[model samples]
Target: MGAARTSDRRRRRAVPWVVLGLWIAVLALTSPFASKLADVQRDRAVDYLPASADSTQVAKIQDRLPGGETTQMVVVYHRDAGLTEADKATAADQIAEIAGSHRLTGEPVGVPSKDGTTLMYPVASNEPGIDEKARDELVNDVRDVARGGDGLNVEVGGEGALATDAAEVYNSLDGPLLYTTVAVVALLLIIIYRSPFLWLVPLFVAGVANYLSMGVAYGLNQWFGTSVSGQSSGIMTILVFGAGTDYALLLVARYREELRRIERPYEAMVAALKGCGPAVLASSGTVAAGLLCLLAADLNSSRGMGPLGTVGVLCALVAMLTLLPAVLVLLGRRVFWPLIPRYGSTPKARRSLFAAMGSSAGRRPRTVLVGGALLLGALALGTLNLPGAIKQEDSFTSKPDAVAAMETLGRAYPERSTQPITVITPADRAETTLADIRGTQGVDSAEQGRTGGGWAEISVIAKDAPQSAGETTTIEDLRDKLDGSYVGGPSAEQIDLKDTNARDRLIVVPIVLVSVLLILIALLRSVVAPLILVAAVVAVWGAALGIGGLVFGPVFGYEGTDPGLGLLSFVFLVALGVDYGIFLMHRMREESLNGAEPVTAALTALRTTGGVIASAGLVLAATFAVLTNMPMVQLVELGFVIAVGVLLDTFLVRTYLVTSASVALRRKVWWPGALSKEPADPVPPKEPERVTAAAH
Candidate 1:
């Protein structure tokens, strides 16, 4: 027995070093792949669009055309007071210079606006083809040569230029997003722990987990040809820090409590794992299941996000459960410094914020429940104010050069569209398609441009502004008029993106709700409890989106909303919000099993787990809040909604509504489970017989 105990202690001492060594090896292997994740990320509209969408088909067919893919640009030269003789001469000279430099599809034709204030030179180049770097360089060269002076304004505007500008914003997100998220998490941890050294452990572990998730993401992309974009990768990074830190907080809090009871750090960590492991596992599993529900979506980005998000969460889970415990055990109790939990020493007793909250909730369960529901319902009403799908020019928080040019075109050409709608038809029917497109109701002008790969491309201009209702009607009319032809362009892509998102919301939201509810039911073994949690998270999601609706346009000055915002935010909020609910309900269930009354168990659970849940929620919310400071409006809106939802869930729903509901429901909260039934009265233990001094 003595040898067994000594051997166990030795093994425990050796385990930390082994874990550290293994992690170092894993990091070394994964670092290369992590570094390469950026190379495979695709951010084109086609990359995000549904595979069967007409716009997606057009884009794919264009790539197989004569020159692979053309880089089209329109050089807009405008003067508010109309072009003078010298202004025309200057425009002519610049047009000649551009034409001489690049291989344009046709001669530079300057289309003067009816008001004579704007002159746009239609320029198309097959030189750069499908090479993104080359395309951006070409656009930059055109912008450099097409500069204006005095009253004149020259702007480079086209699909190619807009893509380049958007790409810059997405590419710039990775470094700053990671740094900001790490900083926010670190600050929150320092405040929560109030211990310098203890905070670093979890932060460091989360960073490793982030790196590992990136490597794994890249592997998935390479192996399965999974679509990855700057959007999905950025969200993945947020999850790594947000969800990883959450798991760390729960583990650390439980470990601290155990340290005061158990003498050895190893034994205490084991006890901590036993205490909180099921809840952590169940929570992460719930999140992963919810994210995976996105696979049913038709949109390419949404489908790809399902796996990438799950990778981030599962990576965080593994790191928190393994690397976190190993490090904490190795560091032992002094890692907490001034607030070190000493074995056999009583902790300082004080009233906690959650305790006061639980008391109010316990005292007036029904009132609190109804009041919370009313507040959520009121907040949800703001969804009516949400802006429509964002347009290209309104996508950025700050106006980019392409957006500036597009705006100029929009103002100058109010009677006709500056952007061309592309139509691809079978090569055999090229002439018929071109004639049909020209005869279409909304057609301003139609021209045959490129023909190759068994398809012919036609550029058709509408008699209305880009993305306007009239232009949409024109595109629809053209689509109806021309059979077996794929009609597409920037506006068409936006239309497809918006429609697909709406469809995805109907499909993915239900899947996420059902999957999460089922997981909760299995974890809690109670239908009513799971229903309450699902309803609470759904309310939180609505309230969060409603907050976005109230603030996105009015307060933040955003012009429109991203098409995917509704579906993505719902998935994230419901999945993450339920994590706190799990912590609270699981603790409440444990207390009930230990023979405490339902109301007593509910209050005790709240008082015990509330602080940890609050801390975790704050960490998660803060990490997401970092996205609000990002450059793109889509990222900012997403970050804001999710952050707001987390706070509401943590402080309001989990702490108040859930506790009160449990109290009100009493044993019925655990109905169909053993705890729902009444137990027999406790029997006194038999007293031992006393021995006389003579007997001894």
Candidate 2:
């Protein structure tokens, strides 16, 4: 007996050091790859295109050409009154300097608008050769040489310039987003735990999980050809912090509860893990299963995000369940400082927000359910008000130089398009294809641009501005006229993206719903409960998007929506929103199995898990809200919609509506499940005991 006890003591002492050493080693191994993630991130339209898109084919062909993918840009010089002789000379001189400094595919051609207020030059170069840094340098170098003053405006625009500007925005987001997320989580944790030292534990663990996720993400990219975009990568970081912290909250809360009963800290932690580990695992499993369903998506960015997000949530779970417990046990109860949860200590008696809400919901369950359903249905109607597909120029919250230049072109060249539509055809048909492209309806002109690898590239300019209806007609007409050729460029890429997103929604949405439903069924072993959660999350998504629709245009001044916003947001909201539902329902199942009556079980589960769920929701929502401050409009919109949905689900739906429905339905909520058949005799209901708020 003495030897066994000594051996146990030694094992306990070694656990923390072992776990700490493992984490340090993980950090060391992941550091190099994690730091290089930014290097592999691709921001170009082609990088995001659907695999079967003509735009993707065009990009592939361009990459195989002699110059290895040309960077096309437009330099616009404008004067409202008219272009003076000096202005024309300055424009020409600037173009000359640019051509001299860089390897141009051909001589830059200056095209004067009919209004005489603008002189635009079409510049193309292959020196960048698919290298993002070189392309950005080329664009920046050309912009530096084309400076304007004295009422003359100059701006560099087009696909290459736009890509550079977007990349800058994405790169800038990496640091600020992480910093802001950390600060927010720390502050919220401090408030919830009220212990200066306790909050740091989860935050540090989450940071470790985030770092590990980044390395794994980079590996996935290198090994499996996963497409990493700014949006996908940013969301992955958010999930790591948000989801990781959520798991920590659940584990810590249960641990605190277990500590009140068990004497030894390590033994208490073991009991806590035994009690709630399955729920945490089920929640993370559902999130991973739902995210993995994104593989069915046609959008490359969305598909890649699925795996990266799964990696984040799973890593966070592992850290919280293993590393966190080890650290906490080593530190003991003193880590809580002024608010340490001592064994044999009873919590103070106070009415909790959820308990109060549950009381009201219990009294009028049907009324509350009906009202909540009506509210969600009404909010969902806002989707009809959402704007159309976003144009590339309008994708930024603040206008960059590329957008400004495009705006100038729109105003000065109102009757024509400045952006080129690239078409690739058989080299033998170059002459005839060029002629046919020029003759196509809405074509302002056509020229043979590049020829290599048995292919000829033709550039076509439409009669109307880029993204306008006239240009759309012209692009379609050209594709129809040149059936064997691939017609693509910035405009066609957008069209393909929009079409592909619609298809992905039809496919991936159902997959996500089914996948999540299956996981819930397996976890809860109840068909009715899973359906309710699914319905609730779907309603939350609709209502959240409706809120976005209501605000995105009239409040935020955005005129367009991202093509895949609906699908991506739905997947996130459904998968993540259901997290709270799982926690609540899992606790309720525990209560039922422990012989509590239906209503008692429901209210007790809510009373026990409410504070943690609320804290988790706040942290998750705040983390997502951080994205709204980003310059990219898509991130802002995505962040806003999801944050709103989570808040709605947390406070209104999860607390009031779900609780009320559970009360009204009683045991039928678990219909056909084993729990429903094994109900104990009914006990008179009483107010649920309140959990300590510090557990949050």
Candidate 3:
């Protein structure tokens, strides 16, 4: 029986390499097809366009209309007396010259402020264009011209310049951030494992998962005509490396433990897989489900992120289960060459801290449960004052183009720098047309132009700046009133204007919450379990937001929260927190079926799992902390909040909650079946004895 069992273990251990090879082949063959697939979709989408709806027709109509290329850049020229009419005219001329020279297809119109203190040049893009590279060149060229020999302190600000600057900031930080994160994680892993080869193992596996996931994401973009932006790229890197390393740690840690039990290396590998496979699968399933829930999001960008992130996680899981095990099998015992521990013939016995804690919790269930609840409740208090703001101006680093543009606008034409509100009134309605729109509340100025045969475009500049949510609300109310009061237009006639800020917030919140909830339920396999998990997740999210608001709002003078923060917080909390829950629950389940009693089982599980969970949490937290080195405010906030949340989940929630729950339920913890009502213990298999050769 022993020989047969050993043979069976060897076969199982060899299977993963075969699977890894197959996956590698699939990734290779699929990579080249990504570009081809994208081309096919692009061609089909282009061909299906209406004949009258060509790009030229759209461009011509937009240029001739008031709100066609309604967005503008504000150029702030500061001097002792602000700007005289002569100075304004010269600035305008200089701007126009630069625009013309640089092939800037925009209507450069300069208007001095009503106070006559600042000059504002509102340049509208003729092509409705905002290209990062082109905009950067235009801004730089304009800056050079405006500042040269004029002795005029002039600054150019607008969406184009701001976006270009933000991109530059990101580009500057990307290489350093990537290297730093990789280096930090590598060093941390080495410290924990105390093995150079083991450190490389996780890094190598994560790299494969990262690259393959990127290839898969490219394929997804090709198939769906989705744009994968820089944000998504950063997220892809974090997810693939952080999550991949996590799974590797779990598997390798178990492999080492199993090695201390079995003599043969192959037997140990198979034993480790059998023990760790289910836990890894559950953890991966939760993460994948959470990310996949992004599909339900209203925003195209976020919806794209769902599948992109999910692919990375799934790839990591596949690599951990297949490639990682295969590598271990091939390396055999040499993988841990220098650090092999001396072992006796008998299995060693040692009391684990997690086991002690679990035992205590099982003995005193109320204490553990109540204590945990109180801690979470206290943390959740910060959430009550949670503020949700999506300020694009604040999303990037302080040095980003967007921030510079906003600052320039605030200094120059604060009113005009604000985005214009487009009010669509039916042309057929004489009472609600351009003339009527000019008379509406808060309208500083109104420009009307024909959009089509029956639709009139009314562009209204607000009395106040448009960055605030209050401004957004005012615009929304104006639209509602216009639509409801104007009955003389076509029944289908409606207002369609983009609220970039509000649209971002609305799309991010539900998508993140729903995605996280789905992932929790999939992992826990109980409806109640997911609900509680999500509640904890929400608490963590709220805490993160509150902390961010306080730090950014008060310390940095950032007035409001960046919308991207909410979405990022959601993903990070879910991914990292779920890992904690998975680690704890895995051990909890194992103990419930193996330990002598419910209390003993809880104690044993905690002792065994607590150390690993803590180690994994520290690694993940440190990995996220690397984001602090990024130039972007969003990344910094995301890194800090996620790191904090991981620490909380790992040390406080996972340790206490699982222990308390195990004790409270006792035998009933298993529920409906009680795990067969057998005493929790590992039943040793009978060993076969060989017959004596002399007697035979």
Model 1 lDDT per residue over 1-696, tens place: 678767877888999889889999999999999999999988888789998999999989998998877777889999999988888899899989988998888897998988999999988898888888888898998988998999999999888899999888998999999999999999999999999799999999999999999999999999998889999999999999999999999999999887777778888888899999999999999999999999999999999999999999999999999999999988989899979998767678999999999999999999999999999999999999999888988989888888999999988888899888999999999999989888888889999988998999999999998898899999989878889999999989998999999999999998898899889988999999999999999999999999899999899999899999999999999999988899999999888877788898899999999999999999999989998998899999999999999999999999999999999999898877877777787334233232221221
Summing lDDT over every window of 10 consecutive residues in candidate 3, give the lowest-scoring window: 488-497
TM for every model, in the order presented, reads: 0.97, 0.97, 0.80
Ranking by lDDT: 1, 2, 3
With candidate 2 superimposed using the best TM-score fit, by how many Å does residue 217's alpha carbon deviate from the native?
0.7
Question: Which residue pairs in candidate 2 collide?
Answer: none
Off by over 4 Å in 2: 678-696
lDDT for predicted candidate 3 compared with the true structure: 0.61
lDDT of 3 by residue, 436-480 (tens): 555656657867644554555555676766555455545554655
Per-residue lDDT over 111-169 for candidate 2, one digit per residue giving the tens place of the 0 to 100 score: 89898999999999999998899999999999999999999999999899999999999
